[model samples]
Target: MTLKEIVDKLGATVGLGADKLDREEEYCFASDLMSDVLTLKDTPVLVTGLCNVQTIRTCDMANLEVVIFVRGKRPTEDMVELADENDMILICTPYSMFKTCGILYGAGMKPLY
Candidate 1:
């Protein structure tokens, strides 16, 4: 689903990249470790409990287009600025990681194979 659609369905609030909210994301990966995400090849939406600037750097290195911070953790100002610099869409959801992943997966989003 498109980022905009996901936001609408989950009632998530956009933290960054508001203008690019309509961008389509075909896949998702849930993790807090940047190293693991760096190994991924397919472009996907990232779901993490992490809310730091390093997450933005990892997203840049991994070529991810979107990040949804689960459990309502707010991204720091530095992270938001870095995400804006990297052109990544950042969002926050009230759902826990497991529930959020399930919801997205049920909605047809998958991890990169």
Candidate 2:
């Protein structure tokens, strides 16, 4: 599914990279553990509740293109700048991590496993 669709489904706000909302994403992995994030092979779209600069850094390192911040958490300005610099997309939703994952999964987003 497209990032646009995911955002719509999750009622998320685009904190950055709004122009790239049409980007297609077939897989996703939700986790708060940065170490686990690094272990993924494809680095699928990251659905995380960890809203920090390090989250952006980890995704950049892993080549994950998108991050969905759950529970309405917003990234700091520093995090936004870093993600923008890396051309990464950041999305925020008011739902819990579990709901975020479920909505995305129900929308046909595949899991890494």
Candidate 3:
């Protein structure tokens, strides 16, 4: 699904880079640890509870097109700026990590590897 679709389906808020919402997402990964995310061989739509500038940096290294912050964790001002600079789409969801991943997976979003 596209980032726009994920946001619409999940009732998520576009925290930043709404223009990039059209980017397509093939998979979703839910994790709080950057280290675990880094280990993923395939790039996926990252769903995380951690909200910080580091998330943007990790997205950069991972080449992640979309990031969904679950449980309503808002990104910082710096994080928004970093996401813009990195050309990443940021989203905020009210759902917890488990529910968010489950919903996406149930909707046929598989992990890329």
Order of candidates by lDDT, top first?
2, 1, 3
Model 1 residue 100 CA deviation in Å? 0.6
Error of 1 at 45 (Å): 0.4
For candidate 1, the per-residue lDDT at 31 reads 92
Instruction: Tell me the TM-score of model 1.
Output: 0.94
What TM-score does structure 2 among the candidates reach? 0.97
Stretches of model 2 off by over 4 angstroms after superposition: none
Q: What is the clash tally of candidate 2?
A: 0
lDDT tens readout by residue for model 3, 1-113? 88888898788999888887777777788889999888887778899999988888988998876899999999998888888888778899999998888889988899664
Task: Assess each prediction's global lDDT (C-alpha) against the native.
Answer: 0.86, 0.92, 0.86
> Model 2 — which ten-residue stretch has the worst lDDT?
38-47
Task: Report the Cα lDDT for residue 45, model 3.
Answer: 85
lDDT string, candidate 1, 1-113, tens digits: 78888998677999988888767778888999888889887878889998888888988987886999999999988888888888888899998999888889899997776
Q: Which candidate is the best by lDDT?
A: 2
The pairs that clash in candidate 1 are: none
